[model samples]
Target: MASSAELHQRRSAAVARGVSSMIPSYVSTAGGGTMTDVDGREWIDFAAGIAVTNVGNAAPRVVEAVQAQVERFTHTCFMIAPYEQYVAVCEELAALTPGDFDKRSALFSSGAEAVENAVKIARHATGRPAVVVFDHAYHGRTNLTMALTAKVMPYKQGFGPFAGEIYRVAMSYPLRDGRSGAAAAAYAIGQIEKTVGAVNVAAVLIEPIQGEGGFVVPAEGFLPAIAAWSRAAGAVFIADEIQTGFCRTGEWFASTHEGIEPDLITTAKGIAGGLPLAAVTGRAEIMDSVHPGGLGGTYGGNPIACAAALATIETMRELDLAAAARHIESVARPRLEALAAKHPAIGEVRGRGAMLALEVVIPGEDTAAGPAPDAVLTAAVAKAAHELGLLLLTCGTYGNVIRLLPPLIISDDELDRGLSLLEQAFASSL
Candidate 1:
């Protein structure tokens, strides 16, 4: 096997510079929370391919299903030559997604496409022009989604002129705003009502638990209140569950935790056990509102990806990964909380189930005034972890959060080892 250094040297000459890699090494194989690089170095994976491998890397059932699918066929876009796997996957989505009402789903190749279509459906159904988004929200990188996302650098930077009529509102960030859930909701509601009139709004889109934006879990009552407001205003309530869906947050979807059934839910990351598959599941009426030809891409809902999705869903249910996510939280939260207590640089430990994060900040800041973000220190800690062979990720609008997205199937011993390495990283970086 080629050393990572040699591979990287070759890659620099071949791969596009704009395409960035978090880990410098090339992976040779991975399964169940661990990966081996081309150089034969082993790593305890906590990123889970950015939460896409909730069923674990190359899960047996998923591998078998994909192999069978490959033997049968690969492509045959659902739009042209429809397949049973596509229909079956949609049926499973309807059954699994939140909301007791009749739900319909549209399969796509990525989260951005799901989100973009959800917005289109919302706009078409409501006959409205404006869409509302919250601060620190990350929808996607597509032109329309870039307009919806809050971050400026990398995602949105140099990518304009973006889609218009998108309005930004306040998010119920408990750590930053120091407001109660209801108060935060009220504040956001006030902003929407004033900036984008309720009569003209098509959708109120938000991540039930923000991803990439620091795993900022809003306070209790925030999401429900927002959903109620959207309903009363006749706007679609869209939950961008692309990152928090599946069993990542100990629930089929994070909106269920708040008991909020969004009119539209966009899902992707963990849906297909790491295969490229995404979906928009919503109330049948709103979903069907779009014209038959209005929503679909040539490669949308490819048969092989659909097959993988079915197997992934089966694996999630068969293994009860939601309970596993809760178990991960039970084991990891206290350790992270203790780490926070010991390290002054660690401002807060937040998030749910297996989707958790530690917000790194300047030490000794006034508690009432909000600690300042320390992105440099956060990067240093991440670098230290990487050197120690722990694959972790950093996120946040301010880039000061160490987010952990360990696979639900990871062993407790691996979690402990990762945590120990993380602690050492923090200590050494500080």
Candidate 2:
């Protein structure tokens, strides 16, 4: 195994400069809440592969399922030679996703692909050309999704001539706006009505809990209000739960928390126990609107990925990981709140279940001046935590939010250790 420095040198030469990695070292093995790098240094994993390893890395059931699947065959391309695992995965999705209505699903290779398909389904079903999105939201990196995404620098800087008819509106950001859910919703609805016009809209797409956009949890009634407006306007309400789905938020989907039943929901990240799999689950009529040949890719639902997804769903059920996410909230939220109380730099702590964040801002009178993001301090704290063997991830449109996404299966002791390391990092960085 190469040393971290040697591997980084090799990677710089071989890997594209555009591809970014959060950590300095290369991992050799990972399970539960920690990963060991090539140098044999172990670091507690709070990032959870950016919430992809919700069932924990290499869980026994997922590993067994993947091995059995590989033994049977790796690729048959479901479009050509469909397999049982693919069907089974879809069936599970129908049963597990938020809405109780008769639903159908289409499998894809990434969250971005799933989102693109959802938008396609929406436009086809409604016979409308316009799509609605929110500020500080992240759908994906694909051209269409990049248009949907709000960030400019890293995601959409060079990518241009993006898909048209995608409209952006203000989201229900309580910390910044200090507006009630209804007021925020009214403002957003007014913007849509005045600019995009409800008649022209095909879909109102948003992250139930905005990911990459700082884990911004909408005000209590915000999501329900948006869903209601979308319903009244005859537009599809699409929940982009790509980062907050599959028990990451203490529910099968975050929309469930608000009791908002979306017409379509896009999911990935935690769906397949780290394998590349994504899905768009929604109403049957809407999904069926597309022609038979219109909705698949050659590698859309690979057998191995499907197998992993089925096993992952089963593991989530068997372990009651939704409850585990709640437990994580119980344990982590207070600590984060306490950290905020102690450090004036931490302007807010937001999010639900296992998905949480600390918005770093300028301390004291400057905080009152405005929500001035303290990106430098955020970078220092993340860097400190990484060097101290606790991996943390920073996000936000302003690049001033520290997000914690520990694997659901992480032990109490491991979580405590990570929290302590974070505190130390805060003390040192501040």
Candidate 3:
């Protein structure tokens, strides 16, 4: 077993020094909902590789599919050879996504790629030059997606000359703004009307539940309002479901709870169960708007990822992970909420289904009170959790929110164990 120091030194040499990790212990392998480092130490994996392994790491069916696909043929490029798995998964996405009407689906290699393509499709369909995005929204790192993304520091840092025709507005964060969902939506739309002029906008992109900005769930009526505004403006409504889709939010997609069908939906993360794959699924009309040959990359829809996606979608259905996500919420919310009640530092706890977070705000201070360093105890809580064998992440524009996105397949005992550690961390921190 490698010592933590030895592992860290080796990793620095082998992997890019720029790659960031919260844990010094390197996970060699994972299963179900937990992972072990090369040092033989185990940790409860609440991160799920930032919500990618929802079907549980190394899911049996997904493994088998990948193995089978690799043996059959790893790549012929779907745009060139075109495989059955690609079509099958698209079919599955069409069925699984919220809308019942005719839909079209396209596969890509990464979440960023899916997002960029969705924008391109929207632009081509609407013949509009402008796109509206929300502040604190995390679309991706690609050039276009970087412009689409809301946060600045790391993602947008030094990468400018971003795609033109991009505009940003604030999101509905009650803890930070003290505004209701309706107010946030109205304010955001007003920004568009006043600054960007929605008349030239091709699409309005949003995260149903903002993922990188700390699993922030907008107030009720917030998303519906935006969708309504977009419809009236003749702009495509794009829901970036890369993090919130595939039962992470207790439902198939967070937008479903609000009864909104996005014109173009970008999905990834759990879609292929830890495989490098993403997708854009939406109404046939909008998707077909793109001319043939408009979208296709060499490794866009690798056969291996497609096979894994097929297996992944099948596993989610057979195991009913959507219901499992609801079960997770039933288990986690009460325990986490109890922790919140006991700790005044926790200003708010909010989310839908298994995607939830507790905002750690300094008492008597709002989350937006000067950059979240002195106030939110997020760093302390995260440090405490890691020492006790639990992984933690602090997200949000201000870095004041700690979100939990564990695998929906985690056992009751595991959830209780993780929560117990969390409670102990809270008690000791105070």
**Cα lDDT of model 3 by residue, 61-172, tens digit:** 9999999888998789888888888888889889988878899998898999999999999999999999999878999898888998888878898989898999988888
What's the lDDT for all of these models?
A: 0.93, 0.94, 0.86
RMSD of 2: 1.1
Worst 10 residues of 1 by lDDT: 363-372
| Two-way lDDT contest, 1 vs 2, winner | 2
**RMSD list, candidates in order:** 1.1, 1.1, 1.7
TM-scores for all candidates: the values are: 0.98, 0.99, 0.96
lDDT tens digits, residue span 279-363, model 2: 9999999999999989999888889999999999999999999999999999999999999999999999999899999999986
TM-score, prediction 1: 0.98
User: Which parts of model 1 are misplaced by more than 4 Å?
Assistant: 366-369
| Candidate number with greatest lDDT | 2
Once model 1 is optimally superposed onto the true structure by TM-score, how far is the C-alpha of residue 67 displaced, in angstroms? 1.0
Off by over 4 Å in 2: 365-369
lDDT of 2 at 199: 99
Clashing pairs in 3: 213-396, 214-396
lDDT of 2: 0.94
Q: RMSD to the native, candidate 1?
A: 1.1
